[model samples]
Target: MAEKGLVLLYTGNGKGKTTAALGLALRTAGHGQKIFMIQFMKGNPKYGEIQASKFIPNFTVVQKGRDTFVRKGNPEPVDLELAKEGLNLAKDILQKGEHDLVILDEINVAVDFGLLKEEDVEDLIKFKKPNTTLVLTGRYASEKLISIADMVSEVEEIKHHYKKGIPAQAGIEF
Candidate 1:
């Protein structure tokens, strides 16, 4: 890890964005670093990461969104409200200098879906503490997000089992 922490953005259509973020969280936790993961647009309790998180000490995970997928350009009031709540929480988490790493999972998708304003995300990046590594994970990462990131990785998907009619499995795809 960088001495001053690093801003990392994981985006693209491929799977493992969140998986990579969680892998970071796990690695950080193994080293006794605190990690706070705020999952935007993910209210599903069945995700393997969420369940695995229960066993990791100092690894806090919060899911803020509806279980059902929010339609693009036609989100429900609840979806908007939940995303706002998560953003507010993110602000507080960043300002307070609480955790070593803060992961905003699926936040880019939230912005793309109009559940969150891009300006607010820019603010999150701007206001983050110097020593806090902020990790944003999700598809459709905005240009602004790419610009602010100290490290950016785009997960490109050439092939996926889901394309072959393999449903999302619990441990792998949840």
Candidate 2:
């Protein structure tokens, strides 16, 4: 474990927020470091990352939402419950300091969508171990998170293939 773990925040109205976190996870795995990714508002196991986890040693991906889309303004009761469950899992993982890298995928979006409270997440982050690198990925990151992070990257979507009638590719977008 490193002496000083970093708090990395990847956010913005863009495409690479989660991709950036996944890249770190890949690098961590390459170095034989353990990584645990808790995917919020994403339950589908068909995502490339989740499928790829089977072959990647020491990398785990867990999703905590239904397969269907979660309505932004009016999320279901299960959605709220799942988000809380994911948060609790994250807190336990952070406290244990088992993984070298811990990623809360789409956490910012979950907060922005009111699935999780910002204060709850802020409190959760306080439990991070000194040796565990923490990552938060999603759009609409709050100012408090950005201020507290050791590194923050906002992915700006200058252009997207979806706008040009191009569907998301399997490996590329998944």
Candidate 3:
């Protein structure tokens, strides 16, 4: 068991938010710690992280949502259901102490899009185990979440190839 766990938040309007969390996942799994990732608002099987997690012993990645993008204020019913399901699973995993690290990938964006309530996310944190570090990633993190997190990192995008009309390539952006 861990001595203690931290609530880490990775947010901002830039790329690499999920990448950073997956990097942490790799580190945790490398240390022989069990890790679970609930990728909300992302359901692509071809993502490098998803494929890589398959090879990691203690790393489990579950993707929720469709390949299409969720509209800001017009999320579908299925989107809401998937996000809620992911949040519920995360809460259960955290409470059960089955994983040393739990990463809620793109959960901040789910909250921002109204697929989840900030209070629900708060409840998950409240039920977190002492030894389970919870990492929340994605853009538009709430102020309340930042206030409560033990560590917060915002990845700002100065420039990107996407802005240059370059498509998101596999292994790079998936």
Candidate 4:
């Protein structure tokens, strides 16, 4: 098997960015490779990562964001602190090199929102292990990140339930 490390950037203004990262984690885990996922800008527990954590031993999912979602026009100080903590944890994990694959879920959103600095991310990318695959997922990927990434995927939003007056559904949208 090939043992080359790669930077994967999943961006765009659409859904399934995190889902795609998680799918890669599951696939890697199936191959007996340990996977670690750090979630930024996410606090709710009613999601796929929580469900996967129950049965996947090799999968470690950590949510460092606030317990409540950050909404527009009313950002809380705690949200920023939580995002910082999460980013720090992710950096530590990336440096540890214990896992075969590390997924920085929704990290781009955190960076775009100014919760984490771009320089810090660039540093992390620089120090990643030679054989450790790193996957970053979120909308609005920065140009610097795209330049360093080995592969980039953009999810386009063409249509959605929100536009049709339908609320987000459990196990489908969540």
Candidate 5:
């Protein structure tokens, strides 16, 4: 059994939001605890973390979007369906309490982009087991989510390599 779990949120218009969550997942896996990540609005199997999870014990990564970018305020029907499917999977993961750490990757963006409803995510958080640590990542985290979270980290982008004409490198940003 795990210690008292926390509801953590990492948000803002900066990089490392998902990186921070992955760091925590790594720590959890280091302790031989289970970790599950459901990535919303991202379906690229080539991502470094998705590739690395294959070698990590008791760690699972599920992607729920296509390789194409989702247009804000006009997401496709398949995007909506995939997001809903991911949310339902998250709910089941929380209820079952099978994983010590659960990461809802890019869920805030999904909600902000109208792919998923805020209330539904809120209720999912409420339904989470006491022993399961929940981590929500992505920008534009709602006030309600912040209020409910035990800890919230906003990663403000002071500077970025992307603005410096540097493209995303493999294993660094994926």
Candidate 6:
């Protein structure tokens, strides 16, 4: 079989981007493929990513960006720094060619929020390993990214509990 990686971009206004990627990661890990995840725009320790890391071997999950919810107008320097670190780690993993799949979780939000530059993302895409599948998740994906992706999935929000003033529940949301 030809060992080549493909780019996967998941974007939309609704939810499930990260969840989709996580599902993919779990599937890949079950097949004995190494996986790595870099989470951007997320700092909460009580996330599902943390729990997955505990049992999954050959998996690394890094959380960067602010712990608080993102605001449109205000972005702190710490958030930017954390995002940069996450991007750098993703790049390093991609270049190393160690993992079979690398998930840039919430990268679209990072790029949209201006924490991660589009140019750097483009460079990562350009230099990615031949057999390293890359999955980017978040809303507001860039046109350039979409064009390069082998598979693009958009999770549209038809209905959400948050709209009805329901808080994010554990296991389901996290």
Q: Please report, in order, the local distance difference test score of every candidate based on alpha carbons.
A: 0.93, 0.94, 0.92, 0.85, 0.95, 0.88
Candidate 4 regions exceeding 4 Å error are 71-74
Q: Tell me the deviation in Å of residue 158 in model 4.
A: 1.3
Which of the two candidates, 1 or 5, achieves a greater TM-score against the reference? Answer: 5
Q: What shift in Å separates residue 83 of candidate 3 from its native position after superposition?
A: 0.9
Compared with the true structure, model 2 gives a TM-score of 0.97
The superposed Cα distance between candidate 5 and the true structure at residue 118, in angstroms, equals 0.5
Write out the backbone clash pairs for model 4: none
Please identify which of the two predictions, 4 or 6, would achieve the higher lDDT against the true structure.
6
Best by lDDT: 5
TM-scores vs. true structure, each candidate:
0.97, 0.97, 0.97, 0.93, 0.97, 0.95
Mind giving the per-residue lDDT tens digits that candidate 4 earns over 7-34? 9999999888888988898889899999
Candidate 3 ranges with C-alpha deviation above 4 Å: none
Per-residue CA lDDT of model 6 for 118-168, tens digit only, reads: 888989887689988999999989998999899999999999999999998
How many residue pairs clash in model 3? 0
Model 5 residue runs over 4 Å out of place are none
lDDT digits (tens) for residues 36-127 of candidate 1 = 99999889888888888889999999999878989999999999999999999999999998899999999999999999999999999877
After superposition, candidate 6 runs with Cα above 4 Å error: none
- Residue pairs with backbone atoms closer than 3 Å in model 2 (clashes): none
> What local lDDT does model 4 show for residue 117?
81
Encode model 2's per-residue lDDT on 1-174: one tens digit a residue. 437888999998889888899999999999999999999999989999999999999999999988888899799999999999999999999999999999999999999999999998899789998889999999999999999999999999899989999998989888
lDDT of 1 at 69: 87
Which consecutive 10 residues in model 3 have the weakest lDDT in total?
A: 1-10
